[model samples]
Target: MPELPEVEGVVRDLRPIVEGKTIAQVALSETVFTSHDAGKQTIVKNNEPHQFERLIQQMTIIELKRRSKYIFFQLEKDGETFHLINHLGMTGAWFVVNDITEITEDKFRKHIHAVFTLTTGELLVFSDIRRFGELRFIKEIEEHPPLLKMAPEPFDEDACDFFITQSEKPKYRNKPIKEVIMDGQVISGCGNIYATESLFKMNIHPGRKTNRISRERKQQLFQVICDVLQESINSGGSTISDYRSINGGAGTMQHRLKMYGKKQCLTCDTTTKSIVIAGRTSTYCPKCQR
Candidate 1:
């Protein structure tokens, strides 16, 4: 799953290439999922795929923004403006190609579920091997259920306070700090990998109760979260598995991870340990993170 840093990196790489460009054509594989709204029950089916073409063909992309792990495209057609939201599920990736010929030569074509033909003769392709990704067209992004329900981005100034407040609440107070931070409603886009890394950096155990953390320690944890996320973005995000930049390149941050996948602590002689919290594998240094 792509987290804040990976999605942020995608937004940065896509803005320059897709902005100001008109959609010459839109091609979607039948296996690709499409929805008119954010609800799972509102899935488009049967001949509805053609409806996707009808709604999006020739629409111009004005801007691109990332909300949580979702990609938003500000689109225009005639005088009407709408939004396209993409959720890259598990194995999804976007790539730009010079032409359709490049698509055939590319190794990932078999999984290329969606392609946007640009006026510049370039092809923007989205490939998802597992087909868990989604493409949605919504008239108002703010009112869309998914976007509407998301908490503020982790980089938002109020996010730290929000985390602290949420931690003190009964719903989250007794939960493991790792699980608390991983809640998208508490803090968006802080996934398993980054949360583990951040907690390790703050010398906080992943299994610590959220309410057990002191105010000062919470402040440090908040800063560590921001620092780890920003550093991951700077390093192009971790590419532990399926994540890739728009240019089909792997992120370097995985190589720089301190505790997420480590067997031993770099700071101390203590061995690292793994446990499941919120159903995700968490790694931490037993001696360093307490």
Candidate 2:
């Protein structure tokens, strides 16, 4: 899954190309973007193919932003505004291409399900092999329950405080620190890969209970998470699998990974230990991490 850095890269890449430009055409090859909240799969939530076409075509993209792992497209036409919220679940990606024939990657070629041609003469293509990606067009983002319930962005001034307060809560105190940080409602945008790296860097065991750790340690871990995420973004985000930038460039962060999928500890030279937490594989240096 594309986490904060990856999603932020997409937002930054897309903002320049899509914002202030009207969409010229919207084409779907039987494409359906789903919403876990409504459990419906049309183009977006309630809009059918034709309806979605009518709603988005010719609307100028006002802005593009990222919250957690979601990409937001602010659209407007005739003084009416609507938000297109996209979650690139699992294998989903957006590509900028001048022509579909320019695509050479086999995964993107095979999974090019939706195409949004902009009036600027460029094309925005969406490819998702697993179909777990979501694109919803709504009046406002917070109106959606799932989006509404999301924690503040990790860069928010109060995000660390929120994490600490949530960690000290009765329900989360007993939870593993790995799971606590991975929770979207607790700390948005840090997922399994980033959390594992953060824990390893902070010398904290992934399975350490939240309450067992001191408040100072928790604050340190939060800072480590931010550093790891920022580093990944600087490297264009990790291409753990098929993650790519809008220009179809792969991220180099995977080459710099210290944990997550390592066999031997780079620091202590001890064999790494692995566990399943929050339904994701977490690897840590046994001798290095406490």
Candidate 3:
């Protein structure tokens, strides 16, 4: 799955190409993006049939925002009327090109499922071999999922408070730290990759209970989570699997990983091991993370 860092990388690569441009065309294959919010999809297609056409030659993209893994485009046309929200679920990605290049099955091969053309003569493509990505139109941005209920981005006071509140919850107190972090309600956007890396950074056992976690350790965990996430973004995100930047480039962060997919610890050179927690694989160094 594309975690927050990987998604952030795509956002960075996309902003420059799609920011000031107008949508020229919108295309979708037979598969429809479905979830708890099924109604919005139709709303998007109906409300903007001409879609990128009007914007292609007229409007300008004012700003871009991300909530959890969803990316929202703030289109400015005299005032804030409507904006486009896109979610790249697992195996989904956006590709930008400078010309009307022919999209061969070889480009993304079978992964190319949707395409959007911009007025700047650039082609914005979406490829999701699994058909899990979604696009929606919104009059009010907060209707989106991550923006609607997710905790603040990383270090906001609201996010910090939310983190503390979740960590202290009685029912979750006995769960392993990785399980707690991966709990979307506790903090959105964390996945198996970050869950493992964050615990390893803070030297906390992945199996440690939330109740048993010390206040100092909690503070440390908070810092490490932010640090690790920011570092991943700076490094362009990990691309060990289907993840790729919007520019069709691979991320280099996987080279700096401490212990996610490796069998040996990068720090102490001990053999990395794993155990099952909350139905997900938990990897760590027994020597570094107690």
Candidate 4:
């Protein structure tokens, strides 16, 4: 899944390509409105395909923003402001091209599920092989439930304090440090890869109880999280398996990863270990991570 950095990079790149361009036509695959294809849910949510097309076809994109792992498209039509949201769950990717047949990447060209044809003669293509991603049109953001639980962005001023406060809650005291940071209510946009790397940097084990971590360490962890996310955004975000930029470029951050998928710690030369927390694998150096 594309985390904050990945989604942020995509949103940044998509702005110049898509913003201000009117969607002349909205094309959706049959797989979008149909039932699950091999356990996948309907990719286009919130309305039927024709209704979604009716609402979005002529809307002009004004701006694009990222929240956590989601993308928000600020749209306008006849002086009315509306919103469209996209969540790239696991395998989703976007591409901007003049012609889809000119696409060279197999995964991108073959799995395209939605195409937003712009009056600018460019097509904004959405492809998701796993079909876990979703696109929705809504009048207001508050209509979605998940956005309501999103905490402050990791780089926001009060995010660290919010993290500390959320950690102190009785229900979260016993939660693993890994799980705590990944909690949407505790901190936004810290996903499995970033959480694992941040823990490795802070020398805190993933399974360490949240209450056992000092407030100072939690503060430092928040800063490290910000740093990691910033570094990733700078590096164009990590491309572990399926993440790609709007132009089809893969991120180089994977080469800079320290602990996420290593067999040995580069710092201590200690053998690394793996554990599953919340069904995600966390790789850490036993000697390097406390």
Question: Candidate 4 on 52-90: residue-level lDDT in tens?
Answer: 877898899998989878899999999999989999988
Q: Find the candidate with the highest TM-score and give its number.
A: 4
RMSD of each: 3.2, 2.6, 4.0, 1.6
Which digits, one per residue and each the tens of the lDDT, describe model 3 over residues 1-290?
78788888888888876776776566654444342235544323434434433443344667676767778777666664567777777677778765434444354645665566667777778777665666666667566554566666775667767888878888678888889888777876788888899998888889988888886788778778888888888888888777667756888889888889989988889998899999988998988988
1 against 3, candidate with superior TM-score = 1
Report the lDDT of model 2 for residue 257: 86
lDDT of 2 by residue, 1-290 (tens): 89999898888877877788888888765545333234555435545755676778988889899989998898998999999888888877888889987878888778876788999889888888777777788897667888887889888999999999999999899999999999999999999899999999989999999898999999999999999999998988998777777867778888988987899998888999998987888899888887
Instruction: Give the clash count for each candidate.
Output: 0, 0, 3, 0
- Mark the 10 consecutive residues where model 2 has the least summed lDDT: 29-38
lDDT of 1 by residue, 210-239 (tens): 888998898888889889999999999988
lDDT of 4 at 39: 45
Model 3 poorest 10 in a row by lDDT? 35-44
Model 3: how far residue 219 lies from native, Å: 0.7
Alpha carbon lDDT at 284, candidate 4: 83
Mark the regions of model 4 whose C-alpha exceeds 4 Å error after superposition: 36-40
Question: Per-candidate TM vs. native?
Answer: 0.91, 0.93, 0.83, 0.96
Q: Give the distance in Å from residue 278's predicted Cα in candidate 3 to where it truly belongs.
A: 3.3
TM accuracy, model 4: 0.96
